[model samples]
Target: MPNTQSRLQVRVIDIHGHRGARGLFPENTLEGYAYALSTGIRTLELDIQLTADDILVATHDFTLSTAQTRNSEGQWLTGTGPESITLTAAELKSYDIGGLKAGSPYGAKFPDQAFLDGVTIPTLEEIMVFCSDYETSSGAGSITLNIEVKSDPTRPGHTDRAEKTVDILLALIEKHAYADKVIIQSFDWAILDFVQDKASHLKRSYLTIAAHNGEHATIYKGSPWLGRTQCLSDDETIPALIKKAGGNNWSSLYKDLDEQAVSEARALGIGLYVWTVNETEDIDRMIDLGVDAIISDYPSRVQRRLMAHQMHWLGDC
Candidate 1:
C-alpha cells in the first residue's frame, strides 16, 4: 500500500452521486442522472434489479414502493406492488417514480428534491447510452458507473441467482465496452466471489452496513448474504474478508467504519469508499479518515467540503 500519510497530504477524493443525486432530483430517474452530471459528478452510483424478461433496470428497491411510485393508472400504490423480478421491462416502465408522495414522511426526507411528473425507470442499457451521448455532446469524459446488484439470500426468488445476475450484468458491461468504467458492488458477498472467478478483470466493491454487530461483529458470522459459512472464519475482519474474496474496494456505511478498519484496509491496499455521507460534519469526518471516495446524495455538499480543504479533485470517467 502507498504511504497513508502521503495520501492524506494530497487528498484527491472521488465523489460518487448516490442514486443520481437523490436529494436534488428524483431518485434513479434519467432526469436525476442528468442533473447530477450537470453538477460535474463523474461517478454515477446506482442500483440494478432484473426485470422479468431478464433485463437490468435502474431502481433502488426490488419492489415498487408506494412512497415514491405511482401505478400505471396514475394512482399511488397502497403498498408494495409486484416485485421487479416478476414484471417485464415494459411492465416495470409503466410505473412513474418521478416524485415522492407529497407531505409524506418519505418526501420529507428529501425536502429539496424537485418534484417531476411522468418519470419512468431507466434500463441499464438506456443509462449507458445516455452517458455515452452526454459525453459526446458535452465534450466531458465518460462517466464511471458504480452499479450495485440488488440481491438478498433471505428473499429467494425475488431476484435472479447470483451466478445468473453476474453473467447478465457482465454481458451488458462487455456489450457497452464499459468494463473499464464500471465497478460492480453488492452487499451480497456471493456475487463478489462469482465475479472474482468469472471476470477477474472487472473491479469489485464489497459493501457493508452495521447490520452485523456484537457477537456477529465479524462478517463470517454476521453477514447473511455470504450464503455459506465455511468460506471465512468467525474471527476474520471485514477488510480481510474483502481481500480474500478478491474485492478491489471496501464500501461501508460511514458510521460503521472506525480508524482501525480504515487503517487495515489501507494497509491491505484496499480502496475505501463510504456511503450516504451527506452532512458537512460527516463529510469532514470521511475526508479526515482519508477515504478514497465518498458516495453521497448531495455531491455538491461533498464538493464544497473538499473545496474548503483544497483537496477537491474532479475525476474523469
Candidate 2:
C-alpha cells in the first residue's frame, strides 16, 4: 500500500462530490445535492439526460432503474421501463427517485445512504437555480458544477444526439450565466469535440473508463458508444485521446490510473480528476499521486483525509 501519511507538495485537490455524494444521499436529486452542499462541498459532479420534451434533467441513467426509482403509484420500476428520451419532463416527474429500493443489488452498493422519501429527479435548470439561491442565502461562494452529458451512441434513440445534447446543455448554462462556473464533461468524445468546436471558452473534461472485452469494449477504443471512432488511436493512452478531443481535464476511473499516465497528463496541461473513490486507502493513494481533484461518492471521507494532511480545499469547512 502507498504511504497514507505522506502528503504531496501540490495545490489542494478539489473534492468533487460525485452525484452529490451518492454513498450518503440519493444520486442526482436536489435533496442529495443540498446535503452535499451543507457538508461544505463546493464542487458537485453530476450527470445530465434529455427528457422526452427536450428538457435536460440531472440523472445518471438513461432510464429509470428498478433499484433506485419508484413510480408515482409507489411501486419500484422494473426491467428498464421507459427511456428518459421518450418521456416528457412532466411524465418523467411522476417517479420518485428519492430513495433506493431496499435489499436490491444497487442499493446494497450504497449501504450508508440516508433515505429521503418523495424526492423526484430534478431538472438541470432546477439544480442551477438551487445552487444560485444557496450561494445567496448561505453567503458561500458559488458551487463549481461538473455536468456530464449522458449519451451513448450504441443505444440509438435512447438519448438525444451528441450535438443536440451539447446545444441544450449550453443553452441552459448560458441562460443561467453558469458558463464561467461549469465544467462540461462526457465519456462520449463526440460531445466534447462538438463543445470544443463551438463553445471553446467553456471548460471541458473528458471522462473515461478502461476498455472491457466484448459488449463493453468501446470504453477503451476511440469511442465505444459511437458508430465511428472519433480520434481513437489504439496506441495512445486515454489521457492522450482526451487531450486530442480538446478536453482541458481528464477524469478517469480511479482504478485505471497509474503514475506515468498522471505525469503525462500533467505535462499535457490536462487536470487529473479521478472518480467514485470511496475507501480511505484509495483516497490516500489518489492524494499521494497529486491528482487535481477527487470525484468521490463520499466527499466527507475525502474531506477528512485532506483535513488530516492540512490540505482541505475549503480550509476548515
Candidate 3:
C-alpha cells in the first residue's frame, strides 16, 4: 500500500506539531508534544541536539536560548546562554523551556503560558515513552517523530559530526523501537545524506532554508534549489528555489506555498511539508494546497480547521 502519511482521503493532509505546538504550549518540550497530540496533531516535529555525552535531547535552539528557556533558579534565559553541546544530559535536564515570547505573530497571543519550575529537557527516550503511552491512551495513530539532527558539516567541533549525530539519533530511536515511526530531516543535506546512507529505511527530508546566493539565482541546473545553495533573500522564492534544488522529499514555509506549486511538486513525486504555521487562515490555505503534511504551532487550530473544512467540503460536494 502507499504510505498513509503522504496524503488525506478527501480534503487536506496531516498536521505536524511544530516543535510540539510552540505557540499553544512550549517549543520542543515533552509537554509541548503531549499537548499537541491531545489537541489532535498527528506528527510531532521536533529538533534533536546531542549533548557532550551524546544523549539525544529534543530542543530547537542550538544554545540554551534565553527567550524560551529558564535555568534551575526559575530565571528565564534572555540571550544565547549555554551551548547545548557543552552540557551533559544530566546537567541539561535541569532547565525548563515552557514559556517565552513564543515566536512571531504568536508571542502576542499566548500571554499567560505557565512557567513550570523543575521541568527538565527530555531525552528522545522520554519523548518516545510519552508518545507510545499517549497512543494507548488517546487512540491516535502511530505518532511520527521528525527529529532534525542539528549538525553542520562546516561547523566542526560544535555538535557531533553528521555521521555521529545520525548514529546517536538512530540508536536512541531504535532503542525506543520507533524505526518505522520516525522521519529524520535537516537543512544540512550532508547530514541527510549521512542518515540516508546509514539507515535507508527511515524516511528523510532535506530542509531548504533561505540560502545566501548573491543575485536572485536563476535555474542553477533547471531544477529548484534543494541542494544548490541560494542567497537568503526575501525577494526570491524559497519554495520554488527548493523545488528547483530538488531532493527525495521537500519541506518549505507555509506562507511561501500555494496550490499550484504543491500540485507541481506532487506531479514530480516530491512530498510537501510546510513549517511553523499557527493561524487558521494559513491552516486553511495549507489544506487548499493539498500539502502532504504541515508543521504548525497550533495543532489544535489545524485539526479544527481541517475537520470543519472537510464537513463543509462534504456538504458542498
Candidate 4:
C-alpha cells in the first residue's frame, strides 16, 4: 500500500465521465452531459461515429442499437437499426436516444439511468460547443474531452475510410480550437497513426483491451486493430507499443491490468488510464494502483472514492 504522503502526492485522479455518466443519464445525449457537468466532472469521454454524409456524430455502437434508439414517431426499434453511416446527420438524429427500452438487455445494465424524451444525437461539434458553453456558464474552467474515434479495419463498410474520418475530425478539432483540450483516442491504431502523422502536436491516446469475454482484443500479434505500421513482438508490452507509436497515454480494460504492467507503464513515462471502472471496489483498487486517470460511468462514485482517500480529482492546485 502507498503511504499517506505518497497518496497525497497525487494531485488529481483525472476522473473522465464515460459516455457522459452512462449510469446516471442517457449515454452521449446532451442531457446526460449536462448531468455529468453538474457533478463537476471536467473530463468527458465520448465516442463518435461517421454518418453517410461524412458528418461526425456522437454514438457508441456501430449499429443504431435496438436497446436505446427510437424512431422519429417514438416507437422503439424492433430490431437493430441501420448503421449511422447509412444515414445523414439529420436522418440519424431523427431517432430518439434519450431513453432506454423498457426490457432491453442494455437497459438492464444501467438500471439507475434516467430517461428523457425527444433527445436526439448531437453532432460532434455540437457536443464540443455545448461543453465549452457549459464551462463558461458554470465556471468549471477548462474541460478535457476524451474523444474516441470508433473504427474497425475489418468492418470497412460500416463507416468511411479511416483517413477520411480522421481528416474530418481533425478539421473540426482545429476549427473549434480544441487541439489543446482534446485527446484523440481509438481502438484502431490506424486512426491514431493518422492523427500522429497529420497533426503531431495533438495528443494521441492508444486504447487497448487485452481480453474481454466477448470483445476483440487488439494486443495480439498481427491484429488488424493495431494498424499497418504496428504489430506486437513475441515479447512486448502494450505500453511499449504505445511508446513506440509516440503516444504518451494508454487506456485499457481495468480488469486486464496488473501491478507489473502498471509499473512498466510508469517506468516508460506513459500515463496509464483505466476505463469503465464503475464498481467501488475496482475504483479503489485503481486508486491504489495510482493510475493517471479513471474513466467511469458513475463520476460521483469515483469522486467519493477519491474523497475517501483524502484525494481529489481536481487536485489541490
Q: Which candidate leads the pack in TM-score?
A: 4
Tell me which of candidates 1 and 3 scores higher on TM-score: 1
Q: Write the per-residue lDDT of candidate 4 for residues 1-317, one digit (tens) a residue.
A: 23555645755789999999999899988898888888888889999988889999999988899989888789888866787777899998889998888887899998889888889999999998998888788886888899999997788573347889999999999898899999989999889889999999998888998844235677876778877556646356788888887888999889878899999899999998899899999999999999989999999999998878877888543
For candidate 3, write residues 1-317 as lDDT tens digits: 12342234445467788888776666778777777777656688888887888788887676776666667777767646888877899888887766664562344566645555556689888899999998888875678888776765445574345568777787887788898888888776656666666787788776654333333323233323223355354555544554444455677656556666676677777788888777777777777777778787677777677667652112111
- What stretches of model 2 exceed 4 Å from their correct place? 1-10, 158-160, 212-222, 225-233, 315-317
**Cα misplacement distance, residue 15 of candidate 4 (Å):** 0.4
lDDT ranking from best candidate downward: 4, 1, 2, 3
Ranking by TM-score: 4, 1, 2, 3
Please write out the lDDT profile of model 1 over residues 36-111, one tens digit for every residue.
9998889999999887788999988877888888877788888656788888889989988988888789899998
**Candidate 4 versus the native: TM-score?**
0.94
Candidate no. 3 TM-score: 0.80
Instruction: Report lDDT (Cα) of residue 169, candidate 3.
Output: 80
TM-score of model 2 vs. true structure: 0.91
Instruction: Tell me how many clashing residue pairs each candidate has.
Output: 0, 1, 17, 0
Q: Which lDDT values do the candidates have, in the order given? A: 0.84, 0.82, 0.68, 0.86
lDDT of 2 by residue, 98-140 (tens): 8888989999999889887788889999999999999999988
**Candidate 4 or 1, higher TM-score:** 4
TM-score of each: 0.92, 0.91, 0.80, 0.94
| Deviation in Å, model 1, residue 112 alpha carbon | 1.0
Q: Clashing pairs in model 2?
A: 218-224
Model 3, runs deviating above 4 Å: 1-9, 101-112, 153-160, 210-246, 311-317
